[model samples]
Target: MAWTWTYETADGRETGRSAEFETRSDAESWVGEAFGELLEQGVDQVRLFDGSDEVYGPMSLHPA
Candidate 1:
């Protein structure tokens, strides 16, 4: 299954999506590297998916 990410706003509006990845680890790594840029683009949070199944997240870009 392809792994992917959906970028969202603080209010839960989806604003963007990521390129499909071959593995969940790759998807997570990509998000780890890109979250800063995503925040600059107005994405406050992100969700990970394994095809149609949600793996995790609504993870915030801000440090907590």
Candidate 2:
């Protein structure tokens, strides 16, 4: 299944997408590498998906 990450703002507005991946691990790894810069650009949360199915998260990028 193709995996992707949706980047969003704190209020749930979608801001962008990560490059598509063939596996979830690659998708998550891409997020790990770029999440800091994404947060700096005002991405407040992220969600992972396999096609239209959400795997998890609207997870906060900010430290709690």
The number of clashing residue pairs in each candidate reads 0, 0
lDDT of 2 at 34: 88
Every candidate's lDDT: 0.91, 0.91
State candidate 1's TM-score. 0.95
Across 1-64, the per-residue lDDT of candidate 1 in tens digits comes to: 9999999999889988899999988998999899889989989999999998988888899999
Per-residue lDDT of 1-64 in model 2, one digit per residue for the tens?
7899899999999999888899998988888888889988999999999998999999888889
Model 1 residue 46 lDDT score: 93
Q: Give the Å shift of residue 53 in candidate 2.
A: 0.6
Give the TM-scores of the predictions, in the order they appear: 0.95, 0.91
- The global Cα lDDT (0 to 1) of model 1 is 0.91
Instruction: Give residue 8's lDDT in candidate 2 (0 to 100).
Output: 95
Q: Highest TM-score, which number?
A: 1
CA RMSD for every model?
0.7, 0.9
